[model samples]
Target: MFTAESSFTGDFKLVPLKWAERARKSYPLESTSTAKAVNYGMYTPESMWNKCTYVISELLNECLVGSWVFAISPTAADLSTIASWISDILVDSASLVLVVLEWFQVLSAWEKTFGMPVLTRQDSEVTYSIVPAKCYWTVFAHAGASWQAKHVELVTQLREKVAIRKAAAANKQKRPEDDEDDDEVDARLHKARKRPQKNENKMQTILPTEKAKAAQQVEQPEEEEAVDICSDDSDDGYIYSDEDYSE
Candidate 1:
């Protein structure tokens, strides 16, 4: 997102060399031949400084927006404070919610991608909170709590197929007499998975159900083709974005 080239305009390729030459030319000659000349050059152009400041401000704004969204605790007081902060920022008063939401208009889009920004009503007081993007485990647990026996059984079956296979393979080289067929090993694994009584109530489903996957597909259809975000097509280690923000 950010690049070094964005800090300057025009032919800045020779700026460093030019600055060195200027420093040498401007240096005052000392009368004593043995005296060491230590010239500190502060020769940055005004345009370069302004460009750098703009880039820094933009980066800070993005960071503020991201951190505020992710790190804030889910609380009414915090929500109210942030809302007021946003209001102040919109009026050019700057209360640290650094995003220019008017420019990108991606706040609501992000909410859709993550989850609903939850609102709670307690008596006469109404409070709002943003659910974190990576709360899938919490969401699934809440959903799976009221699941029917059929759904629970289905999820359990679909959940740990890979783990089961891995355990089977690992145990295959154990003792000659202990060696067992895949079916036997699988059955053993299923029995072993059920042995942990503490998590019996908790749904063990990490992956989504087939029906849910299908529903998601229907809701958000895939693009015709994948679009690469990198500016350059080369497979070199360096990545370049289109939003270089050059002056």
Candidate 2:
């Protein structure tokens, strides 16, 4: 439902485009050179960027109102900048749960999204945690048996939501064949319909029951004509023939 023209409004469009254009300073896309040389041009990236925007917007729109997961696997030039643009667009949305994975390596602020710090170093090794929603983000951040148990439980619940979303998406993308196994379903239905049945006999009934047609053919009693018994010029008074009833 989210089209490029309708999804972004006022500042939503302006801010992201501004950020994407600004990121050209670091990322250096091909469009940047054209815009700089022309001195007046829109610094829009390739069409692929628009597709990415559409998908992200659609997922976030769903996530804002419904239970869904909006994931971003950033692998391109200026990823941090792209991350910031994503943050700006999602900043105003309520109930937004963001998860960041520093798969390549942790940037300066890779440990957080929306300023909720989630990365920590435990025993001189890297570790990650989920900062639950509360007045205090560090409610369950402490390293203790109780805190660990609670964090695990909360993360498990979040994963369950993601799983539900995945399952729903899978079902939404399924084809008719996925639900049907019979190859002769259409053939059987066609054969069933083609079979002669008694239902149609009422329309084409046999001759004996066709009373309306028979009644129209039955002759009616004809009124008699007055005889010319006193005719002056008659040989046998009048003449009647078989042709008289032919009319």
Clashes of each: 0, 0
TM-score, candidate number 1: 0.15
lDDT of 2 by residue, 158-178 (tens): 557777988998888858785
- Candidate 2 clash pair list: none
TM-score of each: 0.15, 0.28
Clashing pairs in 1: none
What lDDT would each prediction earn against the true structure?
A: 0.31, 0.34
State model 2's lDDT: 0.34
Per-residue error at 217 for model 2, in Å?
5.6
